[model samples]
Structure formats: C-alpha cells, structure tokens
Target: MGALPDGVYHIKLDDQQFLTIGEEGAVTVLPAQDVGQKFEVRRASGDNYAISKPSSIWPSPFVCYDGAPAAPYEGTRVRLRVSDFPPCEWKITAGSRPGTFTIVVAGDGQPLTIGIAPIPIFPPFLQLTSSSGKDLGWTFEEAK
Candidate 1:
C-alpha cells in the first residue's frame, strides 16, 4: 500500500495484509492476518467506498438476457445495458455449461464487479422478460 488518494482501488494482496498510516500520511503495511477480511477507504466526511460481504446475491440490474433452469448450462448469455452516466453495453457468456461466474466491468474510468452464483436447478428454463432503469424481469420453468 502507498498513498491512497481517497478513492476506490483494486488492491492485490500477497496474503492477508493490514494497512496503516504513518505520521507523514504515508501508507504502511502492518502484517498479514485473516483470509477474508474487508476494509473501506473513505474521506473525513464519512463518504466512502467499502469492501464487504455482498448484501444480496442476484443477477445484475442491467442484465438483459438470462436463461434458466437456474442451473449451469453451456451457451448461456447475459446482456447488460448501461445507458446512464456510464454508457456502454456488456455481454457475459458461459463458454460451456454454467457454474459460478464473476464479471468485472471497467471502462471510462469506472469499475464494477458483478457476481453470479451457481444456479439452484430446482426450477428450470429461466428467462428474462423485461427491464427498466434499475429493474429487471426473470421467470423460471419447472423441471420436466
């Protein structure tokens, strides 16, 4: 860690590392600790970005195309439309059969991480029906 200037940084750790600030405002490393500890980088005004356990797990709000059974499948694709501040499009696909997926979006100086969990498979044939600014539609099919 070095002089982090009050913004979100994608940090890479050798193991578990503790971050400390020196007297002169320089960032110093303490020691390696927990395997899955999270931290936040913030300003004095309590404005900050935090790294923590995800509050909920679901498909992306911007995702357009999703196929189901909610289980992993090959040739599955997800389309994302970003028409607001960050104007762009993203298409995520599983090469051959679904499992767990992680997608990172980084462009135009902004970054976001999207996580897709393993499909349950209780119901089958999941499909995307509709979408709005921050809303999305999904339907499921019963197994045959």
Candidate 2:
C-alpha cells in the first residue's frame, strides 16, 4: 500500500467540491479557498494519520469516541472525541490508482473500513516568500 506522507493536501470530492474543516469543528464539502481549504495530515502510529486543520487542536479521526461497527456502513456520522489523542484513528488504504484512497478508522486498536474517498489531487501548498517574509504566492510540489 502507498503511504500518505504527513502534510496539508488539496483533496477534491466526487462532486467536485473540496473537503473543508471549519474553525468550529464542522467538516463539509465546500468551494475551494485559502480559508478552511487546507488540511494537515499528521502521522500518529504505524500507517495511521490524523487529519485536522493546522490551527485546530482536534483531529478528524476522533470521530469515533464511542466504538465503530466491525465494518463500515453508509450513512453513519461519527462524532469527534474533542481531544488530540484520537479515540479513533484512520488508515488510508490504497485504491486502484494514484490519488485514490479508502478511509479506515479504528478505536482502541480494532480497525474498521469507512469506505469513503477523499481524492487528494496535489501535494502540500508551498509558500514562496522573500527574505523579509513578505507574502508572495504558493506552489505545488512533490512530497519529500
């Protein structure tokens, strides 16, 4: 399986909208923009990653404070744990091609497939600034 390195990625949904994390901990598919458009995917343990906004203290994987079913079922809206240490964590299983991945969530060790796709279209957003740190622009590059 291809491992997703930790960083903010620009992911698009099947509906052509982007996955956005609101400052109030609301996750939604909204139009792309700088605000709430970036997501920080951080490594937790092994191949699991914690998805959250750079400024937020909670991670997306925490959406399972109560246990999850042994298998993923559609129409479930799991709630976040409200803590940094995820009550549940996620693993991105590789899909048939690049940029495609399936989400799996686990709580206290038992992992279960969520069977959802958050199609990542590019790598981290690179900020290009002058020596004085003035704002310039952004660029997309290969993950190191």
Candidate 3:
C-alpha cells in the first residue's frame, strides 16, 4: 500500500503483538489488550499522517534530538511531542512483508527500521537500522 488511510488503528507487529503508546508518549509493543495501542491516523496536507491517542487526542509527532521537525537520523531515539502537534511527515510505504508497511520517517527521508535481533525495551525506543530489513513491528491494522 502507498499510505494508510486516515482513521483510528491498532498498530500490530503480528496477530498478537501490538504497538502501544503511553500517556507520557512512550511507545511499546504489547501482547494484548486494546487500552493504549490505538492511534488516530490523520492525513496531513500531503502524504504525511498524524498518529495520536484517541481519548486524549494528543498527536504523535516525531521530533529530532534538538526537537526539530526534521526526520530522525539512524540510532536516534524518537518520541511523541505535543509541542510539534503535527510531528514529522511520515510516508507509509510497502514493507518487506505482505500486509505490512514501512513508516517512512519524513524527518530523515528514510524508512523506520527496527534495531538488532534482541529487540528493544520501553523508555526511549531504539532507532532505525538497515532499510532492507523486515520490521513488521511498524505494521498497523485499522481499528474497528
């Protein structure tokens, strides 16, 4: 798919694991539950989409180290900042697997890639790695 249509969705890495955004703007992959795993995908002026919490309506905007609107570099930790509200322009491009998509970091003009095999914990999520990897962790399904 080119870009995910504007709507609310539960980001999924598989049938079980889901990407959950915390109140303090921390992102994590959870096993179950529909509490904080939902994000509002809203189309911006162009191909970018704003991801946010449904209840709080806080936008998940990606910011750089200096808190700029540019794409993040490799190994840079990302977080949702309300100050930027709209965040970086994310390009939803086709991923390495079917039914999955790579969230292109418009800030850095590159796709959002996961780190090494061990996987990352909470707090500050790991940064993007090789662009050719199959990171289904970024794949999300439209919530009902």
Query: What is the lDDT of every predicted structure here?
Result: 0.25, 0.47, 0.59
**Tens digit per residue, CA lDDT, model 1, 68-135:** 21332332333332222112222221212222112222223222233222355421222221211221
Residue-wise C-alpha lDDT for candidate 3, range 60-141, written one tens digit per residue: 3432222445545666554556643665556666766777776656544655554323444443353556575556545677
Model 2 earns a TM-score of 0.56
Every model: Cα RMSD to truth:
19.5, 12.8, 3.5
Cα misplacement distance, residue 16 of candidate 2 (Å)? 2.2
Better of 1 and 2 by TM-score: 2
Q: Which candidate model has the greater TM-score, 1 or 3?
A: 3
| Error of model 3, residue 57, in angstroms | 5.3
C-alpha lDDT of candidate 2 relative to the true structure: 0.47
Flag regions of model 3 displaced more than 4 Å.
Answer: 55-66, 107-126
The alpha-carbon deviation from the true structure for residue 121 of candidate 3, after best TM-score superposition, in angstroms, is 3.9
Which of the predicted structures, 2 or 3, would earn the higher TM-score when compared with the native?
A: 3
Q: Which candidate is the best by lDDT?
A: 3
What lDDT score is found at residue 23 in candidate 2?
A: 41
lDDT of 2 by residue, 35-75 (tens): 76665567877877775545543333343423343443333
Top candidate by TM-score? 3
Q: Model 3, residue 52: what's the lDDT?
A: 63
Badly placed stretches (over 4 Å) of model 2 are: 56-74, 78-81, 107-144
Cα distance off (Å), candidate 1, residue 112: 14
